[model samples]
Target chain A: MSTSAAERAVNYVILIVFAAFALAPIVTVLAAALSPQSGAESAGLAGLHPGNFVDAWSEGEFSRYLRTSVLVAVTVVSVAVIASILSGFAFGTMRFGGSRVLFYLFLLGIMVPAEAIVVPLFYDLREVGLTNTLWAVALPQIAQSIAFGTYWMRAYFRTSPPSLIEAATLDGASPRRVLWSILVPIGRPAVMTLTVLAFMWTWNEFLIPLVMSPNGDFRTAPLALAIFKGQHVQATALLAAAAVLVALPVVIVYLFAQRHFIRGMLEGAVRE
Target chain B: MRHQRRYLPYLYLTPALLLFGTFLLYPLVRSAQFSLFSWDGLGASEFVGFDNYVELFTDEVLRAAFGHALVLILFFSVLPLGLGLVIAAILNRGQVRGLGLFRTVVFLPQVLAMVVVAVAWRQIYAPNGTLNTALRAVGLDELTRTWLGDYTWTLPAVGMVGTWVQTGLVTVLLLAGMGRVPRDLFEAARLDGAGAVREFFAITLPSVRGEIAVALTLTIVAALKTFDLVYVTTGGGPGNSTTVPAYEVFQRAFREGAVGSAAAIAIALTAIIFVLNVIVNRIAEGREE
Candidate 1:
């Protein structure tokens, strides 16, 4: 049905207004980061000063934190994606005793809030002398991502054409070979979505790194930004710069692979 | 071969199961154990049974923290749901030009780290921040206050940040749901002498009931799980006005040395989140049938 011209006009107007509303705060921060540190909270265009990011980077030692974030994200994404593929393939294609029960247990990882477990997980890690190590942060997140990853990939695999698998099986291919050589190649989009998601979550994680790295050995970018905020309460420009630095990696990733990111988020909701 | 066939799936599942057992399931069991004892992290323990749970019900600060979370639901979940429904329905109906660009830009907030969001908003809500400056520039000097510091406004202020971050997500999700809606449904409604509003209410609303439920479940859980936003923006501050159960879990366990109390609160929060999600899902499922 054709929408009225007036209705379409109203739609565009509303869309523009809400889009501005969404971008306003971020723009405010960007403008502030560009302005001089002394005055002018958000200089619109003329008063550009780009040194705040450099200063904040060196002062807050954000390089170390960002590097740590990369390491943790790479660790979590690589392991979680591989593990999810294997387990998701099993859940999607194979039947075994207690499979139903095992799936539910995995579901618990997704359902239970991190706050519910971080306390004990911290102590458990500390007891094993793993606190303040990269493992403390990455391990739990790997497990959490695998939980959703397994669920996501299982859905993909369940709907995959059975004929291909049957053909491979008749040709004397093992399940491992089928999954590794055939399905994984065809399932690149699904796997890519999981990788992007796991990377985003790992990059943005705060509570785990905060609690786990008490000695400041493995603090990630977001945690460093928060701590920097506490110390530099008055330096709005520097803080904005740091916030931008911390958020830039994910924002950049989102920009390039937004299709995968949006698809993963919306599809996850729809499947539920 | 028969024996191997039965256990092959298990072999594939071993890595995932091992991770879950070590990190998730094991830790949960230990957290429950910690909740039953009154022990500092370094000292001997005493079994307090249900006392910590009792304290959660009685402590004014703790109760207020959970109460703040409930109030946050209004801004975070309910407000966003209402707003997203309107925006998404409009987008779907108009099939507006440059839909891709609009979706990409508007949905940007959902991808950023909460710390970044909190920081950006902190600048906006500072006493001399953008919000107050805008207020002053527009001749509303008397209306300004330190948003994150004011006891009366801090909770709502923090909650608005949640609203901003979550609205994009809800809008994007609902838009996807609305995309699946067949055009003939709207055409049929228009044929029956329905106005745009009538068409929306009669067809659009009911069609996306499942999406609405999914939106509510995700947003409500986000409201309850809010820690980073509150931690960075207000620190449950001025008083305990902005604290939530998640923040309390961290504060009690780490700062106050109330390990048992923190675990109890965490367990209670998890139960509330789980139960609420189940209700939302069940309602959606019920309506689907």
Candidate 2:
């Protein structure tokens, strides 16, 4: 496996080039968002400025969109985490007939792409008078998150030492109490990883909200940015600013939970 | 107590089952039923039987969409998986400084909204954008053309963006897989006079087979359902050159009011995905056994 210095230099060069290509577009948008003018015709490296951000904020209705996005993502993540913990504990710890079958059935949700179901989901939601409501967005996402969250927490619980659960059971802890007091306390890392992932995904989701609630009132950040793109195709600087605003939450989440994100991805890939 | 124990598993599964049936399973069946009848979002339905499926097979536009998806599979799945493995290997060897920063930068695209990625890349691929400018600067002016707007190259160009966004995920997955390879295996190879390339093919590649399979499956699935990027960047335009199956489905159901046709397309796409998944899982299982 030994390599000469020249070969090593070549390897580094390749890595650097690939990294640059990977990051170029994102960096370009950040630059665009900071630029001055608000038209694609005038946009370029020379037009780069920060003043367009203020204009974009007002014109894109980004503040309101941001509020909606945060509310939806937080609610989805919170509900998903709690529901998953309960279900994961029950499936992982309690032995009963059809447990494995039911678990696999739940995993089937992973394969059912949202695109395939949007039509019916739209009709069903409209029937319930839930269309254009935040509940429409949050409920579906919570449903989707349960599959992965349950799978993840189940993995976490299976790997946990049995002595703890047994000890809790012997101490007169009910199944619910054991989950709340014993399992959840030890499942913090897995919970945090799931939370970060769920938050990022729910925040970035576009199609669900787009079809479920197209009204400007219920528009999430990504949907808002999309609508902004359609209406303001000529407003390049403002679009860039809105794009940056849309990306900010994910960027911040990555900065704080980069390691956990990596861990979560790796863990999911390896296990499945 | 025995009866309680017997019901406990169902109890545990009730929440997931309810959600899955309502959201995932029910929609799947309903969409299938919808595919047998013609209806708009607001109007009366008429049973059209298998006409929708037949039309999907015969329609030139739908055929082109499938073709585009196949092309995208090359850019999104095949190329990304190959290049990602190379990048992951180099990073694993400690050949690059600031490895953590590099990993973070590469993975940044996966977190960004597709709309944002599309907007940024669309600018870069514009007629007088960075790509063309770079080509001209390198004395390759003749090669310079509108990257996205051009009919012949639009699909490939869009696929390339997909490759960029996805390579990071593939690289990180492979890198994690590589970490699981025993360091002593490489040390042993070096002692036996194995060179870098030989060691990679023999020691590194074989050891990370599971990861390669995982990366391939993920990238393949992502490629098949690619919509947002294409929708934002091209709208499957320039005579539908960049149209993919998912985009076609969206256009039919929403824009064209062809609900039955769209559902048929979705069911067909799902079948294709399911078959691929089974094939991949079987290969992985075979390797394990």
Candidate 3:
């Protein structure tokens, strides 16, 4: 694990350069959002200050936007995780007829871009009076997440020991009881990975909310940020503040669950 | 009677199936039917059979939009592959410093909403933006122009945003793959007087062949289905210069109410994405041997 000092220094220089490239715009945003100057011309830490966040929060109604986003993410994650686990356990454990075909059907959610079906889905939702409702967003997202979730959890369940399930069943536990009592705890890593991913994806989703919740009243933070940008085209500071507000939750969530999120995405990428 | 209990699998899968069927599968099927007709998405419509599909190929703007997405693959996939490999090679070096922090900062964009990225980059590319400011500071004042507004630079400018967002992903994936390469192999390579560049090719490159495919699939898909970045940054603007397939689908369907044409383009876009995905998977699998 040894390298010459020159080589080590070279690595650091490379890392620092790419890091600056990656961090520059985001740091500029942070500066712009915090700057006291409205629509600041320069992008630096010179004018950096706070209070724009307060203005953005109140004026942009980000509180409401954040609430709607949280509701959609929580609803989708809860429903998707539970459903995926149940289905995952079934697919992973039981030797059932048509399971492969059915599992492929679930994966169809992952295969098709939401954009492909979104336009038609808008009309379908309208036909059923579900348009602009939270369900419109949560339901489609849940379907999408479960496609990935089941794929993920199924791998975990399929790979994990069968003795635990066998022991639980021999002890007179029902399937639901076994999942809750034994596999759920054992499946913690997979579930954590799935939870972090679902929340991140659902929270950052724009196209669905844009197409489904055309009402602007029921939209996610990203949707809110886009619409806000239209109004504040000239107000760079305010727009930066609004962007920061929209990005804050995901950034914060990622900060906490980074290990699981990164691991899940990388592993999931390999699997795909 | 005992065999009737086999319904448990079906029962367990119902929740996922019901949601997927109602939301994803049904709509996917309906879009195909919708593509054959001219429906404004409100009133009843007469089916115009295959005409929309014909327009998807013939329409010049739609073709360019699709072409722009293909051009984006160079920035999103090819450029990132080269850049990410360099970063990965550096990070994979012995006793690298601040590795965790570097990774977190680099991967920050992936978690961020594209809207946020687009907004931030818009400021960076503005007429009096940071990019221009920096250029002027460096005494390259003549080179400073509104990046997003310049028609020639618009595509590359947007594509660069994609590269920034994706380089981290490719690097991380490559780094993870590199970690699995035996340290002894590198040691032996160095003892044979192989330089870092040689070591990267001799040992690291072959090891991450699978990851390269995965990275290619991920970035290419993002480039092709790129709506949010286009929507926020330029609105496919400075003319039709930056319009991508995903953006066209939105405009044609919702703004112009050319639902059939939009549907046709959407299907075509999906087919491209699917083919790229499968092709990458196949190539990756092929390389495994």
The CA lDDT of each predicted structure is: 0.89, 0.81, 0.86
Question: Lowest lDDT 10-mer window, candidate 3 chain B?
Answer: B1-10
Misplaced by over 4 Å in model 1 are A39-46, B1-4
Candidate 3 colliding pairs, count: 0
Tens-place lDDT per residue, model 3, A19-42, is 999999999999888776554455
Could you tell me the TM-score of candidate 2?
0.94
lDDT of 1 by residue, A1-272 (tens): 58789988998899899999999999999988887887646553466878888889999999898999999999999999999999999998887899889987777678888898899999878999999998998999988898899889999999889888888888888888889999999999999999999999899988999999999999999999999999999989889999999999999999999999999987765444
- DockQ score for model 1: 0.74
Location of the lowest summed lDDT over 10 successive residues in candidate 2 chain B: B1-10
**In model 1, what lDDT does residue B174 have?**
88
DockQ in order: 0.74, 0.57, 0.68
Give per-model TM-scores: 0.97, 0.94, 0.96
Candidate 3 residue spans exceeding 4 A from truth: A39-48, B1-4
Query: Residue A259 error for model 1, in Å?
Result: 1.5
Ranking by lDDT: 1, 3, 2
TM-score of chain A of each: 0.95, 0.92, 0.94
